[model samples]
Target chain A: MKSLLSVQSHVAHGYVGGRAATFPLQYLGWDVDNINTVNFSNHTGYGHFQGSAIPEPELIKLFQGLNQIGCSYDVVVLGYIPSAELIDVVASEVAALKKSNPSTRYVCDTVMGDQGHLYVNNSCVDAYRKLLSTKIADVITPNQFELELLYGKPIDSEKLLRDAIAYMHDTYGVDHVVISSLDASVLNLQELQLICCAVSSRFKERSQEQSQLQVFLVPEIKSYFTGVGDLFTALLADKLFTNNGNLVLAVNQVLTIMSNVLKLTHQLGIKEFTQHYGEDSCERLAEGRMNDGESMRFFELRIIQAREFYDYSGAGEFSAIEISN
Target chain B: MHRNLLSILSHVCHGYVGNRACVFPLQCCGWDVDTVHTTNYLNHPGHGTFQGEKNDGRTISTIIEGLKKLFDLREYYNVVLVGYCPSAEVMTAVYEELEPIYKTKDRKEGPVFVVDPVLGDNGRLYVPEEVVQVHIDFLKRGLVDLTTPNQFEMELLTDTKFLSWNDVKSACYKFYDTYKVPDFVILSVLIDEQMYSVGFSASTETVFYVPIQEIRCRFSGCGDIFTALLTNEFYSNGRVLSPQVLTLVVDKLHRILLTSFREERARLGRDPDVIHDINLVRLRDLFERSFGGDLEVKYL
Candidate 1:
């Protein structure tokens, strides 16, 4: 069965490994495994809260138990985590998990620092660095800042981007890397952002000049809601697994999915503010629940990114462009 | 608590929009999709009463300010606000100042704002790019109680392009996962994405195949009217159910828009590039009759 293991936690109910990460994967038909490392009453962003964290060994035990089940996982998604201890344990567990089920694809949502700042300690960040520097994960998604922090330098020019990708693959054993919320060329970069993505895996033919990078440009979407990374990574994993581990198809699909959501939020004029709106009642709340009653076809997806999925080898092999824009 | 109904509407007579929504909602709960000539686009800027250019899209801030001024909104408790067309922004703005007055603060029902995504008709974005983000930001903040985004809008929100049930479910649930806004709705189900083979008008016996990209039927502004009526039926009627009932309402709106499309073709004479009915709708059929209650299952 497909499962998602969210490592992060916060006191906020709306964000984090809570409803934000767990429910979507569950609704996506996966037998979601929610392994929250830190469980506060709410997200940490809303200030201090009283809660404890799950130690690395304790957390590893659960995944190890799953390994004992002998059923290979189709996909494994990792989100925010607590201490460096958890990260170290996670890296080892992930490595072992991959060794056992080599076919199992792991997607790491490297949520080091959020929209504003990093929520964890230096030890935790270092753990992510080490975890990422190994072959434990097949895919890594980090926002611009997270990429910078991981690389120990700002990701400004294209050289840095290419170098970063090479570094990730060579040093960390990362197969695929996606850096999000980039203002790469735009002057008002913060408002209008993009995602610089690269894919390199044993599953595909590799090329020296493939660059393995493409920019996922999206209109400006604003907000302070935590766990958007959880949502993005969850959808990405769902798409990746559903598409059967074709990284290009999966990443391309993720871009379209979130872009569509952003477009809808814009078209409908959904404002960025926290308050109960519309005809809110306990009755109305039920309509949003995840059930067959709530299921429906989402939208007409136009595959605009098919041409930009960069997977190639230097075998001098003639290849028809995957798609034409 | 004088329960007043607030509706934000615009875009009255485009080939994609219509004028019957007021009647439909008026028939059910006496609320309307408020109207004006402009999409608030294409007008010279700087006029407070009505300042945007025609195609530029009226600022949500402008529309919200207009709503506050028009309603003199400070006097009410437990207001049911249903917004459509260019009014999604208006619904969001009101939420900031409106929620505290009611919402158990005074043991009253505060302003309940429902936003109907009005980005496209027949599946296309009619507004500017910035507007899409503004709307998403609003929904992300939990300002929208009930959101009626079409199938296309759902893809836009979740960033999925070619989606089946799994992708669609992932996209829909992402709203809850990220923003924690519990009220997200996908309006209709097209029997086929190609729209080429599926879209039909049986009454007129018109079997015009929709182009692959342009498969959706041309309905002017039914979205604005649908969201308005559904929100009113939800908040104004004081219904106490779970989020389950919204799918029923969303399904009904889809069919209502279909029926509205046929009606528009009849009214506007199938103008190929455009249709007649946008704002006008038949609300009772959706909420009161509940679209035969079990009808939405056929598509699922």
Candidate 2:
């Protein structure tokens, strides 16, 4: 069995961070060791969350414990580090793991914020820049905002986005770069259609002229959901490893599973909302104007219910569109 | 529908003990588990060299308080499982935070509190005496609906010596009458080369025993896994304990242990007398399989 070290936030009530990531990986046959960066009551998207980020010293001590036990992992996945200092600690620990094994794959989700909002400290951007400069991360799944942050510029057009992917590959030696979500305006696409792009360095090495990019179009669900990014990164990591570094195949499978999960979550959320506040509440839910804590409960990802979709390898409903620059 | 569970336990980074052993199995069985870790160790101490520290009681209280802010614990979770608190302060903090939910809950409706009083094994106390005292107080207050204790902890809880089945039966009754806990399971009872898990159900007013196959290798996380599976089965069977549930749980556990033993032996090319971390991921299917042919259950 493959072993993975998952470093992320942990909420006691819902699926996010490590809670969202650990189960799917374990179900897909990986031994996951979790290091919770924070222990919150629920996700911060709820607007009223209780809990604090785990102190840096405590985080360091957990790593030291893993080292003392001679624990080594085949993959290390990083998510939701609250501070720049913690990010530095993670970078150093992951560097050490790579140095020791020389084959340990690092999957990093640069979880600063989504849709132009920054939840973590701004300094974390610099920390991530420094970490990526080391080229320790073998795979990175960054949303459009995080990709722009790390590339040190705006990716407002498809051409700019392609340049940014190429920059990540050339500068950081990143083996795989997956743009988890793109702004619809960047590609001038339909409002309800979301795009995901992936590029693999192996493909770039195979062809000298231009890198091959795979784009997947996904339908946007009307309700707000948390932990989608965390879950996507986790499933991608498992699939990438299992599919032997085939980025197109892995991302295709991951998106299929994600689409299925989102569809189920939206259906369940609507059912729950109607049950609580009558059928009229469906409009309020679709508008993303859930005001109270009770409504927030309905938005949690139906992760456990969607377990069967994790190993789904059927013909991809969202097949990748091959793009060459 | 997926059932929700709150698991307060230890977390080891490398091994399957406490939450490490409990969470995956429970999740695979369709439980949404939220965990508050008591200690974060490198691995279980069975490895002889361990690292990590026990979390502060204040941290435990704070996390629980955070959960309470977002959820009505009574309504959110179907089961609350507590196991392996390393310190008395931590244990007390758990009780103080959870007592309110227990107080307001209707016992027959839902949200059963299952405590595995993990003090020690085989006539020894690994934890400090204060921690043991805290567990005693928690049980005596009737804060727990059900508890799974090993033979040694059962002795400590009831202050009785289990020389035979009769002694075990009396202790079970004593526990129920004194603590007001309706159900109890004494894990890993060995008599004349046969292993059994003896249990008492208040609703049924009966004492019964389920035979367990003895794997030669000693495993660290068996008790934690047992408690997790027991809680799952107990909740699934309408919050009640029966011979059928016990038999199914024991049978599943036996298969897992046997698989772990055989795998460890094959890997080492020798007899593995003590297995540190059992392979739950490789044995994932065992947790999902439906076991038929209930073991011969005998009444005391």
Candidate 3:
């Protein structure tokens, strides 16, 4: 059986980070070795949570013990490093493991911030840039803001986005880069749009020569959802590993699953609001009047409720097309 | 409506044991499980040298406190399942933190507390003796709504050693009589070369047995898996520990164990007797074969 090492944050209450990633991988039949960078009372989305981050020393000790076990994993999915120091530790560890088995895939989700807001310390961005420079990760999943950050410039137009993708490929030597979520309003698309991008190369005899970008445009869901990125990275890794690094198929499969999950999340969120504030308040809830406390129950990605959808047959109801430059 | 389960148990990164063994199957059966780890280890201790640390009682208390803050406990969970509390301190902390939810009678109905009294098996104790005492005290206080104890735990709880099937049966009855535990199942007893699992319900005051075909595989986490199957079956069957439930539980357990045993043997290219560990990943695949269908019980 294939195996994955999932290193991320852990929440005791709700799913995020490791909690969000491990289950779907397990359901897809991967033996997962999980190391939590932080153990929190719940996801920070709760506004109030308790618990502490696992110190760098303890994390290193745990990894060393696993190394002693002499088990190699097919993939390693990293997310939500709480500290820059921890990121350095993870980078060294991934470097050593990849050196031992060059075929092992590293799926890195540069989880720094969302919607133009940075959550971690500023040093973390530098650490991520340093790690990406090593080109240790096989696949990188970054949203628009993270893409802009990594590019070291604001991506305000399609030209800049395309340039950023090419720069990342040429500079970082990353085999595949998936921009999971990009605001479509930047492109002046017809109704509030979300653009997902996947860039991969058709290596001619082990040399990086030809590359193509597949763009997926879909109407964005109206509600803000936590754990979507974590879930997306996990599903993307699964599809990529199973599909033999087919970037287009992986992006399509992940978006297909995400669409179902987010759609259910929005419906559940709306139903929770309508039940409490009457049916007339639906528009108000959509207008973003909902607080974290009021929408906590609904905003949760209905992963468990939509468990069967994970086994979805071959990328349902979503497709991506190659973008010509 | 969906059922929610809160499972507090040991977490091993390598193999499925304790909550690792229980959570996936329960989720496969369509319950949303919230897990709190009592200890974190690289693998089950049976694999010999392992790393990781035990979560102190305070950590368990903090997580439970967080749960209380985030959820209206009465309406949030349908089942609270406790397994493999490593130390007496952690066990006591969990019981105290959960006591109100288990003890409270107001605001609709409270969640059912299912305890798998995980002291030890095969006449040996894995945890410190204090933890065993804590489980007995908790049982005596009538805190556990349902419990599945092995023959040794039943013997310890009743202060009786099993000399025969009747002796084990009397001990279970005495435990029910003394503590008035709503439901109890005595698992893994060998009587006259035949393996049997005995169950008793205080509501009925009757005892029943489900015979198990002895497989050579002695894998860890069988008790944990048994308790989870019991919890799922009994909860869905209107909270009855009837013979039917026992038969269903044993049937599923038998198939899983048999398949795991055979698969491990085949993978090792050896006899089943030489296989020491069950492949949980394989077991999960076998279980998912009949995921949504009604589990058939041919023994009944």
Compute the lDDT of residue B91 as modeled in candidate 1.
Answer: 36
Place model 2 in a CAPRI quality band: medium
What is the lDDT for B103 in model 2?
77
Q: Candidate 1, residues A1-325: lDDT per residue as tens digits?
A: 3544444552212235533544445434454444456544335443333345655555666556555544356677777777778888888988888888777778887767854477778777778888877767777888867877778887666677667766776666666676646554522234334333344343223434343455544544444334556666777777766666666666666656555544543333222111224434334334442111111101111111111221211221111122111
Candidates by TM-score, descending order:
2, 3, 1
Top DockQ hit: 2
For residues B61-122, what per-residue lDDT tens digits would candidate 1 score against the true structure?
Answer: 34333344323343431334434444434434544444443344322234555556556544
Give the residue spans of candidate 2 off by over 4 A: A190-192, A198-209, A221-223
Model 2 scores a C-alpha lDDT of 0.85
Question: Cα lDDT for residue B299, model 3?
Answer: 19
**Which lDDT tens digits does candidate 3 get at residues B1-300?**
668889999987667788778887887777878888898777777767778888889988988888787877767889889998889999999999888776755422678878998888888998999998888778787767789888888888898987786787688778987776788887777778878888887667777676788887677777888888889988987777777788778878888888887777777788655333455555666555433323332211
Worst 10 contiguous positions by lDDT, candidate 3 chain B: B291-300
User: Whose DockQ is higher: candidate 2's or candidate 3's?
Assistant: 2
Q: Residue B245 in candidate 3 has what lDDT?
A: 80
lDDT, residue A153, candidate 2? 90
lDDT of 3 by residue, A219-314 (tens): 675536788899989998898888888888777777888888888877776776578668887787667765466567557776677777786658
Q: Which candidate would rank higher by lDDT, 2 or 3? A: 2
lDDT of 2 by residue, A1-325 (tens): 7999999998877888998998889889899988888877788767787777877878888887777677788899999999999999988877777887787889999999877888889999999998988988888999888999999898888788888988887777687899888866776666665555545453334434456777777776433688999999999999888889988888888888998899898788788779878978778766768736778788788888899999986656777777655
Q: Which should have the higher DockQ, number 1 or number 2?
A: 2
